[model samples]
Target: MDDFLERTRQALAAQPFTQLLGATLERMDGEGVALALPLRDELKQQNGFAHGGVLSYLADNALTIAGAMGLGRAVLTSEFKINYLRPAVGATLVARATVIHAGRRQAVCRCDVFARDGHGEKIVATAQGTIAKVDELPAG
Candidate 1:
């Protein structure tokens, strides 16, 4: 793996929530990032579909990852909005994110969450987010 990709994988390994969700780094490079998650019963809702929170989580993390890659520094999501296009019922889910614009202090990113099943892939949600550089994290 390349330097950035290796570092990114390490960073992801440190995230407890990501581990909890069982998300995998499908792709990470200049083109952008693709995060994949296997759909398990624990991640579904009463309707037996992937919950909106799961989709939002994937979008939020993917946006930050894309932003950090574009900025060449660590970033935190400033804000994000997700629109659910349909119920996600599938064996796997993937969130693909790309940097739309990268500035000195921030980056705008777009992400699409798709669910994959025997039929194929279907976009279940779309999101856009602004990511800001973490110049310095405030002390707790």
Candidate 2:
């Protein structure tokens, strides 16, 4: 399991967009996956809050990771919806997701995005999605 998780993490790092966002795998297991990104000025909007696109990206990727890890197979997010609970103002952002259900071809997942700051972590957004299985993931 550790080896599989490590390989998945490496594959994630190899993704150009994920690398551009500086996303990291904080945790991945039977329970779920947690992906984190450090908050940077370049990632913020004009109001100095985390961009909506950034949060959406985290939710989508985290949902896919959770579903893939649960089924021990590769998966892609078919669709997802997210709601911003509040403005994200923090040092880092973490998106944690869990597979609620899984079948032969698809998995349903839920994700919560949080912002970590000097005080602590706060929920910034929530997401739900369906992930469809694939033949295999491309090697890194």
Q: How do all models score by TM-score?
A: 0.95, 0.94
Question: What would the per-residue lDDT of candidate 1 be over residues 17-126, giving only the tens digit for each residue?
Answer: 99999999999877899999999999999999998999999999999999988887567899999999999999999999999999899999999999999999999999
Best-performing candidate as measured by TM-score: 1
lDDT of every model, 2 decimals: 0.92, 0.92
Tens-digit lDDT string for candidate 2 (26-108): 99877789999999999999999999999999999999888887666577788999999999999999999999999888899
Give the lowest summed-lDDT range of ten residues in model 1: 131-140
lDDT of 1: 0.92
